[model samples]
Target: MTPAKTQFSLPDDFNPETLMVAKVTEFGVFHEVRRAAHLAADLVANGAPADLDLAEQILAQVLDRQEHDPADPHHGNFYWMREDEFVEDLNAVEFVLEALIPMMIRHAARLTPALQERLLAAIKLGLMEVARLDVLVAYTNIAALGVLNTCLGGELLQTPEIATRGFGKLLAWIDYTNRSGHPLEYNSPTYTAVTLRSLKLLTDLTADAPTRQAARALTARLGLSAALHIHSGTGRWAGPHGRAYQPTIVCETAPEVERLRAWLTDGTLPRWLASFVDRPMASFSIQETAERSRGIALTTHQTPTFALGVASQSFHPQANVLMLHYARPNAPRPGVLYSRYLLDDKWFGDAYHATDRTKMLNLPDEGRFLGVQEVNRAIGLYAQIGADHFASAKGVLIWTGRDEIDEIWVGEECITELPHRLDVDQAVVVARR
Candidate 1:
């Protein structure tokens, strides 16, 4: 079957001036890079799943679009409405492509050897394009891309000449980033951590003892405590000072590095590593307590708005009670409730809750048997009441103002037994039923 034609069209209501086209382009690059890395790691840890085939097909379409569509500027430079309008900086494209190379290799390995060979051939061409780009490449991007290439060099189909060139470019990028006094946009504690990580991977794969030693020395300079302190204050892993600074996904790095270090040295990654690595490193303790339902004990600690992305919901009796406890600096504050449920096999819910103040219903038995079922029942009842009778139905309820709700449910029927995403605004008194 012929592939669906890729088209570029601005929305009818598209207002180009209000949109940050450059920022969006950068975000796209960053997202693709991170996604590629994540998928690579996943494939390596758990053999290739069938979904990968689907991903490959999608990627192929994207590649074709990038290659053939003149209307679609290769660097996301053109505004959707004005094809002639071009943005000068296309740095993000190179960074994103560089990051994607390693991910593609990992993906290739999971395929048949013949397919793997074909992928490697395609990757070389892509890498060449990435390397030849004229955009002002950042050290972080170069380092990240270099590390991936180093890790997979032995397995990829690229010529030794191409591999060596790619490696050199990566090193140059890292050197520039490390030495440049300019503040990094992605600077933060986690930025340092991921950079170190990429360096370590490169060191390990290339068996470059000198490079490894240098990277270790740099890491040591970025002290664990210093990184943590920075993260606590700024909620990121990036340069200590820079105007281009922004929040990072990998905010907590010291603990993660320590955990990875222990695992590498002792041959066992703690089960806690999974959650610990994902959480804001500084707030790991609070997150853990929230997950374990040990909220009452954690009252002494400060709590912020809790946001959790649920991967699976198949645990136990209290599984439904996904308690999110936040600490208020002053007296008791009302809690906000927002839930994303799977309806008819498709997930739906406002990204933000519309109701802001739902009266907290006192548990029927004064905290005797409050559990998941009771909490869900309360929530379900709230949904049934047409946004009015929610409080009268027993149990705590909160009205997320319409402005707060961002997602819309998209399914024909209510879905159960699927994971739900939840976001709560304040500390909730999860009383026992």
Candidate 2:
């Protein structure tokens, strides 16, 4: 099947004058490199003389940002921002290759000989960085894209060793996911879309039959997981997410949702499962053991009116360890309730120090208690810790909705106010509708 032409254009927020400016202290815009690569590719595909010259300028800007020092471990990688000499994110390569690899496959011949050589060398360096970094498959999005970058890069550059390793990593991810019941970054509304896109790329582009077949099956599995969790009433990706940046899915036409919808409507799902997509969902419960030994069992319960999600163990800051989403009357969006740990008035899962900003370590602070739930009603317990562990310890339960709260109870205590701050340590807390 012939692919439809993508009408590429600059982002709405694009600033031509400040395009080259770099911020010193903060992390650079992540999409800058990606957009530049995409623009360059689009211009080259246009094949006009002026377009080719502009593409060269953009490519030059992108290549100049790459770290070329042979002795440096971060060689061939771009910094978090142009002014960031000290920090570099490994995922930079993954993001770049999302556009770069496909461009190389489709429009390499269109590129001027000189520019083509330069772009090819830059991509090879990027792939080398990916090889050295070796992102764990548990990361879901980056790992899947890393596999694609290396495999596709190998095929493009004729490096069999890299391709072989990429294939091996792909198989390992499949094996690990099958055993764990889901990816380590499970039920993430944000990263799941990225992972699915990577898997779709692998399924479409890989020459290897086994890899292609595996990717297709895995895509379907993830799609099923995503389809199940979407709240039928509110149209929100239901809670108990292993990772989520926002509390709720406010927009039904969100890019991630659209991507998933496209794949689902393409007749990939079975007839029985496809029925669930169009019909109203009544009630369901799903339990997934993300990791058996570490006790990361995730459970989500969904009904038409409300949904409850619980995690046996704490994850990253993006995690919703305990979450409740309920339908709001006369409102299209759902109500959100979730939990997070705070230390010294800061999120505990956040980077503890400035140095750990780019790579946040998942510290072992497993003092959190498990939650028990039956449909919308749930109970959560928190354990107390000494000052030695955390400078200031507190657990924050955030609630967002349009409804007025009539009452809140924590083990027979009637909490009379909204934004209730209380010591939940060694106490059972419950909320009901």
What are the candidates' C-alpha RMSDs? 18.5, 4.9
Q: Which residue segments of model 1 deviate by more than 4 Å?
A: 1-45, 48-59, 65-100, 103-107, 134-139, 142-155, 166-194, 207-228, 231-433
Each prediction's whole-model lDDT (CA): 0.33, 0.70
lDDT of 1 by residue, 75-115 (tens): 32211211213332343333334334455544555555654
In order of appearance, the predictions have TM-scores of 0.39, 0.82
In model 2, the Cα lDDT at residue 242 comes to: 80
Q: What is the model-wide C-alpha lDDT for candidate 2? A: 0.70
**Candidate 2 root-mean-square deviation in Å:** 4.9
Deviation from native of the Cα of residue 165 in model 2, angstroms: 1.2
Tens-place lDDT digits, model 2, residues 1-433: 9565444455566556544322222343433565576677777776666666767777787787788989887888875444456335667777877667877877788777887898889899888889888988888888989888887788888888888889899888888888888888889887887887787767667777877787778877877887787777666777687876542333333533345456666544433455555448698887788865576887889888877888877656567778877787776555677776656665324444232233233322334657776656677666654346656766667666425455667667886665665563635345544
